[model samples]
Target: MKDWDYGELFEAINESYEEFLANGRGEKFAVARAFNEYANMGKIEDIITGVAIGEILASHDKVFIGYIEGITGWLSEVGKKDLKNELSDGEIENLLGRIATVIRDLRNKPIDSNPVA
Candidate 1:
């Protein structure tokens, strides 16, 4: 039920990205790690984490389809839903659009509103 600030989330993601780069990890892995960390923190729900990951992947032109599948599989494993089944192959644009709609819907909701409600 804690309200999340996207600014703080982005800052954390950026820091993680820098750290991952310093350690020779790729951007995709960094993003995945950040998503996992934030989701596991219990402040952000799985759907929000998925949306964040979708947005990050969409922004990166070099992201491979395998990365998307890996993230979707990870989300499915952790969120306990078959999100990978929900996504169609080569539909990254559609996926990003859906994530954007979710983000907009979240923005319209009250800060105290239950995301899972």
Candidate 2:
């Protein structure tokens, strides 16, 4: 993965929605484009920030997904299940850092094998 600037990622996500809202295209088209951008993140590369942005979007009701579930689902998946609530920039960075570290550690863990006794 490329070195990520989570701060930049957060700004980009906010900018994207704001831009979409102001776009000359109709709201439907703008939303479609936004969603396309979300889907394209995986196509271009499995950038953690991209996925993170998507999850952030998912936490909001403005996108037609659902009411705000916060990021609990994501946190739980990464094994930090207890974390919940609105967050400041620094808190978000710390959470993302922990998630990234856990992901890295899991990726690097050796596969285990057992012989039949």
Q: In model 1, where do residues sit more than 4 Å from their true spots?
A: 3-6, 64-98, 101-117
Q: Please, what are the lDDT tens digits per residue for candidate 1 over residues 1-117? A: 255443455556656655765676666567656766766655234554666665565555445545455455544434223334433443434444555554444333333222121
State residue 113's C-alpha deviation in candidate 2, in Å.
47
TM-score of 1: 0.43
lDDT of 1: 0.51
Q: Name the runs in model 2 displaced over 4 angstroms.
A: 1-3, 24-32, 38-75, 80-93, 96-117
The candidate 1 region of ten consecutive residues with least summed lDDT is 108-117
- The stretch of ten residues in a row with the least summed lDDT in candidate 2 is 63-72
Per-candidate TM-scores read: 0.43, 0.38
For all candidates in order, the CA lDDT equals 0.51, 0.43
State residue 82's C-alpha deviation in candidate 1, in Å: 18
Largest TM-score belongs to which candidate?
1
lDDT of 2: 0.43
